[model samples]
Target: MKSFKHTIRALACAFTIAAVSTTAHAAELRLGSGFGDNHSSTRAMRDVFAAKVEELTAGRHTVSVFANSELGQAPEMVNQAQSGINFGVFVSSAFFNSQVPEIGVTNMPFIFSDRETAFKVFDGPFGEKMKPLFEAKGLVVLGFMELGFRNITNSVRPITQPEDLQGLKIRLQNNPVHIATFNLLGASPTSIDASEMFAALSQGVVDAQENPYAVINSFRLYDAKQKYVTDTGHFFDVIVFAVSKTALDAMTEEDREAVIEAGRLATLEQRSYAAADEATNLETVLSKGVELTRLTPEQREAFRTATAPVLDEVKSRLGAELVDEFLSAVDAAK
Candidate 1:
């Protein structure tokens, strides 16, 4: 009789342990980004996001981040996120061209004059119209993360004018709009993944590349391989955190709200960090012996003029109304 009682007690305890383990497994979430913690805006945002989520979830939910293309490349990760193979991705708009072509409009050169104008369009109608398109493709568009205005860096020579860029083998993101813009400016643009850019530049695979000051510093582009830095403000890049709609739908209401609120907080913090320290970053790079080439107003205008045709092509492909709405928001912001 005592043996029968002991068996019953053991079975009850086993069932209780299984129930607790199952509940714990259901509360975890995964996030993906192509860059690691040191130089990546995505990683900065993710770090803050994870902290916020833990706070909002009251420890009920946990998040894991895969940085530096741990899961896959940026473009492939986006597809994985959408297919519900993972929870979310912090990805640049360049990769979105494959899924939603309209967002490529951001890559059009000189469309934004500065960070304020860029945010005006992104936080307004231009960004809103893009929300549905992501949904149609099975992804959720979170708010924008900062990618400062891109400038050119080269080991070859100073790039003060569009002519200077001519015949230079430049590394460009794999987006049609960006490739077209560089080609129009007379560069021999080659599409290369960001992870390989350092080695590519080191091995003379490419002579020049362009990215923001933050990126230049983060990627350690001031190393001996990169001798010149030019603030052309050719175009800006934006990273948006997206979640798989299928995975999002599987979450409880409380969990979804926690994820979103965390993203918003992290974006605001990261943007402030990027914009507030430009002077320091610039000084650091120059101290490393890199020549800083500030474009003369005339030279900037000349470059803009050369790239104007690319805008027409982008609008036609993305739709005139889309561009109009973006411009309207910019005008309103002013």
Candidate 2:
């Protein structure tokens, strides 16, 4: 009888411990971002997501961030999330374009005239129509994170004309559209992953690369042997906060809303912060002793004209009708 009583008490203690642990871990959302935590956008996301999750869940749910490839490379992390290996990743259109070829429409070179046009397309129909497509692939896109516009940075001579890029070896994200676009512009495109780009640029594996000023500043590209910076603004980038559909489905309604709401707020705040920093970031690059090769408005137009073939190439990947729909939506947006 004593033995039976002792066994009963032990089982009760085990059950009690398990119950407490389960409750404690019941609603955690793990997020990953490509940029280091020090970057403004990454830091904004971490702070806003965590604070909003706690507020909306009344402290029952929470969020934590893994920044600077702590989870994995941006593209690989999204794949893992889609496969249900992890929670989610913050990734750019470059990451999504390869997965959903239909998404390549967003990668149309020189599509947006400015950040305002870019925002219109994203916040309007073009962005809304994409959520269902993402859901079909076991990923949940919470909100669009603006990656600003891409411009060329090179160790070679200044690129004031399209002919200047001839035979130049440029590092491009491992995306079909990006590679095709650069190839169309007469550069030898090397498909390098973002995590490896710094080393690739430093070692002369690539002569130039393109990214927004924020990235150039955040990654300290000035230290990577780059010489000239151009304001081609050739393409705008859009990153989505993607979560695993499996994980999202498992969350309680309240917890799920909390997570999504947190992401939406983060997007708004980050976009504002990014807009205000572009000039400052460009100035910082110059202050670091990197030479600026300002693209004349006419030269920018020529680069755009030269890359026009990329739109048709992008259409072929994303489907012609989808491309038309995306462009139409862009026109219709307020």
- How many pairs collide in each candidate, listed in order? 0, 0
Q: Tell me how candidate 1 scores on lDDT.
A: 0.83
What's the TM for model 1?
0.91
- lDDT tens readout by residue for model 2, 156-275: 888888899999999987788888888888999998877888999999999999999988988888898888887888888877778899988988897888888888999888888888
Question: Model 2: clashing residue pairs?
Answer: none
lDDT of each: 0.83, 0.83
Task: Encode model 1's per-residue lDDT on 1-334: one tens digit a residue.
Answer: 8999999999999999999997787666788887656644665655788888888989887788887788888888898989988778887788888899988877888877788878777877768888889989999986688777889999999998888989999998899999999999899999988778888999999999998877777778777399999989888888888889887787789988888888788887877877886777788888899999998899999999999998788788878987777667767776
Give the best candidate by TM-score: 2
Worst 10 residues of 2 by lDDT: 25-34
